[model samples]
Target chain A: MSRRTALAGAVAITALLLQVTVIDRLHLPAGRPDLALVCVVAFALVGGPTYGAVLGFGVGFLADIMPPADHTIGLLALAYAVVGYLAGLVEDVEERSVVTTVLMVGLASAVAVVVFAMIGALLGNAHISLSAVAHSLAATVIYDVVLAPFVVPLVSGAVRHAEPAG
Target chain B: MRDSRRARLVLALLLLTAFTLITLDFRSGGGGPFRTVGNTVFGPIERAVTAVTRPIGSFFASLGHLNSYKSDNAKLRAQNRKLLEELRTSDANRAHLLSLERLDHLAGQAQFRIVAARVVAIGNALDFEWTATIDAGSNDGVRRNQTVINGDGLVGKTLAVGPTTSTIRLGADPEFTAGARLAGTQESGFVDGGGHNPMTFTMLNTRAPLNVGDRLVTAGDTDNHDRPFVPEVPIGRITRVLPTPGQLYRKAVVAPFVDFTSIDIVGVVVAAPRTVPRDSLLPPSPSPTPTPGPGGTGGTGGTGQQSPPPSPGTTSGRRSTSPSPSRTP
Candidate 1:
């Protein structure tokens, strides 16, 4: 595997571990930020659509299988893959402005939350609530916007540095 | 153009992979290989992470509340002393009123071997979902569908069990339901989890006397051992009762005595048990007290003395009239 791919994989696993462990305990007023979501979005922005989609799958799969996860496996993987691919579309822009990047991350986070609930409802989870989706969307957007600036640029810089010479 | 084509191809492949996984997982029944693999690979890491992060989290939390600690400690100490004195007085009175006989009567009604477990994690990503993970699992004799409780009241039941961990769906989850009944009345019904709101209970009989603040307890029908809920466990108190004019049944909202959010230590009843029948099952019926005369005192003394003796041939009839305080509602 390419160094960039390997690094991304490592980061995804670490993000999953942190998401379920420490980040969960952080306990914000709205709710804890989705660390996996942030990482998926950040990496997607850095690596473009294909890389993001693949990374999102890895990360989502990790979450789906993790202990304490009661939902179906790959439900999150599907939701996040779509988010990563969509977020990666911003890479087509010639000059990706700060507002555009933040907005993209926010939008992706909201889409991920809604899509996840919709799919869960489809699978007979019976616990999905529109109000909960909306609340989670709002919280996710705010968290992503705050997190995107730091996470995306750092991941992008690291990936660029680790790029193999032609 | 080639880069875009390659990206599209990769995206398509990933989506297909995701779809295939979802289909396989759904078809294979809950959890499947993905869950086993995930737990095997990630459970230990998560546990270690928790061990490391907990101390740090507590440290920061302690730091944030350092200013209030001294005053709170002093206040708690004074409160503790006052509570100790109150407890002593209550203990003495309770000994006189509720004797060993009464204690045995209560013990006979609760028929389950319980294993205590500690809450290790709350559902975070799925905050809207009512779920938590406890430290004990199959290794500790914990099993799925076992009823979990705290001192105050019913918490929830075990949803899924891992090797060293098990997930509990809190009673506040929308999917949660338990058979329950009003304490003072034979009226039985099912209590449902409210999912962020107070739980709603629907009584089976329309004419069951409805009242606000009436306590509810489990109506343990263990006929279906698959759902082995013990009988007479206190659930909560009714906050509101809504009886529709045309409807045959009444529905009431219950406020659970146990605080779902703050639950720490909990007990899991491991098996369905039968309570030993009390010797004097029937205490008395709710009848008017006669005028306080010599005859009244004599009648009370007679009943009190004979209470412990098993009245012959009245077993079937007396079973229904037992008025043990613990059994009271």
Candidate 2:
């Protein structure tokens, strides 16, 4: 595998571990920030649609089967795969303004939550109430947006550093 | 253009695989081989991470609650003084004797055999489920469907058990439900977790007398094993009685006694009490006397003897029945 791909994979796994262990335990108001999702979006923005989609699937799969997760497996995988692909399509990552990138991250976070709830509903997961879904959607978007600036640039910089200069 | 097409093809294949995995997992009721393998591989790692980061996590937790520490300290000090005063009074002696009598009655009963465990990690942020992983597992005699409780009250039940770890579904999870009984009345119902909202208790008897502040305890199962919950474990107090003009069952909102967000140490009941503890396990009711003047205090001391002080960290002080002494003449 290419160095960039390997670095992205390593980054994604670290983000997943930190997300479940430290970030989720913080119990931040509204909702905890989704570091793994942010990392996936960052990688997608740096590498494009195909890379983002694959990374998202890998990360989401780990999340689904992770200890303490009782939900149907692949539910997160499906939601995040779509999110990664959509994020990668933001177009001209090098030319995009900071404001645009941050906005896109917020939008992606919101979409990931919504799609997760939607798929949860489809799979007969009764826990997905309308009000709960809406509350989490709002919380996830706000927290992720607040977190995007720090995470996105850091992840993108690392990926770029790993890129082979032409 | 060719690269984009190949990328799209890859996306399609990945999506297809995800869907297939979901189908296989859902059809298997989430107990597929993948789940077992994942637990075996990741459970220890997660446990270690939780152990290493707990101090850091608690540091931030305390930081969040820094504002409440002052008031809490003052309240505790006041309570200590009151308890000390009660100890000196002759009336308090009589009350203590009465509790001893009750304890005598419980002397021959079967005791709960519990496996104590520490919460190692919480559920992931992305999922809506409220669950926590405990460090004890099958090796520690922990099993699926065992009731998990802390000092305050019921926390949740074990969902899945690994060799060295187990996952518990907290009482706040929307999908969680447990049979509950009114403390004094013996009126039975089931409690449902409301996620971010208060738990709901629906009584089986449509016309059962319901009131605010009435406490609930686990009804437990008729079977001797008590597979999921033991009888008489405190659940919560009734918060709001929903107006049901023509409903078949009475519904009320309940605030659970345990703080699901901050669970630290919990015990899994491997063996239940021989005789149901009944309402004896519920926290002592708040003082009945509104104004414990010298004369009134003597008379009310007997009532205090009936129940022991509330368990530490129960937050029952706020729900005391009597108005604060400062407010009384």
Candidate 3:
């Protein structure tokens, strides 16, 4: 991998690591802010879904590992891969603005929640309630959107010279 | 169009994947083979994340250390001030423990073994269910039905065990109901979990006078074994007791002694195993807990008591009858 791409990959993993281990612990409103979602959306909006999807898998794989309990290793990997794929869709358009990135974060956060729930369901973790899933989705969308305006510009502006892998 | 089709196909597959995982996990799918695969794929990534985030972890750890240090300093001064009080309480606890240990010695029970586990995963995705995953599993001798304890009190038991990790349903999981006895009065009841926070402890029979602040402990009797299932494990102090004077039984709410909200370390007790030598004819198998853990009893019966709750929607244990002057057998 090119040095810039490799650095971006490391940064993405760091962001996700901070997420499950620390950011997840923040838990305002009994819900956690999806920092990885914001990061993934930012990258994907600038890089396109294909790049986003691939990055998503990388980040998700790391996230799955850092949980308080990481029994099912790749559960997050699958979930994140999907989220990255969705974020990749944002890259089709030419003009990438901060607003667009924030919007992508909100949307991607929703998708992440849904995918996470769906995967948990498949794994037979019986206690998940439909309502909590919905609320988490709503909460993440709002959190990501709120964070997007600040994070997107910082990431996109800083990474302008750093091109994403296709 | 082709790109869109490919993208749509990927999205569709992801949705399918999410759906499949949700269904399988909810059902608990009997065997946790798939989870092992999930762990394998994600293990490297998790390691990388940890290595990459060590600095961040160190920062947080230092902050936590400072807070705890301050709390400890205050506690030590209080301890000095209450030296006399400490002696009194210490004498009382010593007396209590002396009496209890006598009983244990008489019974020839093994000394308690505590194994520390790392917090690997927290919270079940897709639902409001409150649970966590620990790195210790069948390989760690963590078995199905093993009792898990934290600093505060009993958290829950092991449900699923993989080679390297296991799944534990916190006491607050909606489907969990445990057989518990209020410490002070010996009034036994069934503790049930409803939501994510405080859980409810209900006496099957009516007329047990329960109050806020009443402490709860394990009943220590298993129906099948007639042996003390698990040793004296604390549950929590009663936070609220529902008043139902006219009803057959009364229910009380308890704030768990172990703070499920901020759990970092846990110990799983390898309780009385299931593989109790069904017959002498067969060769001895390793473990008996439904899901085997690393360092688990490995089918060794009579090692320790398990505080494991019922699987899914099932719970076992009959309610104690209305307060009798004497203990019911």
Q: Compare the candidates by lDDT and give the number of the best one.
A: 2
lDDT of 3 at B213: 63
Better of 1 and 3 by DockQ: 1
Docking class of 1: acceptable
By DockQ, the best candidate is 2
Return the DockQ of model 3: 0.24
**Residue B285, candidate 2: alpha-carbon lDDT:** 66
Clashes per model (N, Cα, C within 3 A): 1, 0, 64
Better of 1 and 2 by TM-score: 2
When sorted by TM-score, best at the front, the candidate numbers are: 2, 1, 3
Better of 2 and 3 by lDDT: 2
Score chain B of each candidate by TM-score.
0.63, 0.70, 0.56
lDDT of 1 at B159: 69
What is the C-alpha lDDT profile of model 3 across A1-166, one tens digit per residue? 3554675686776675565445544445656676776777677666666666667766765554433342244566676777778777757676766676677677777777776666566555444467657677776678678888987777676567565433
RMSD of each: 11.5, 11.6, 13.9
Task: Write down the worst ten-residue block by lDDT for model 3 chain B.
Answer: B276-285
Instruction: Evaluate residue B297 in candidate 3 and report its C-alpha lDDT on the 0 to 100 scale.
Output: 28
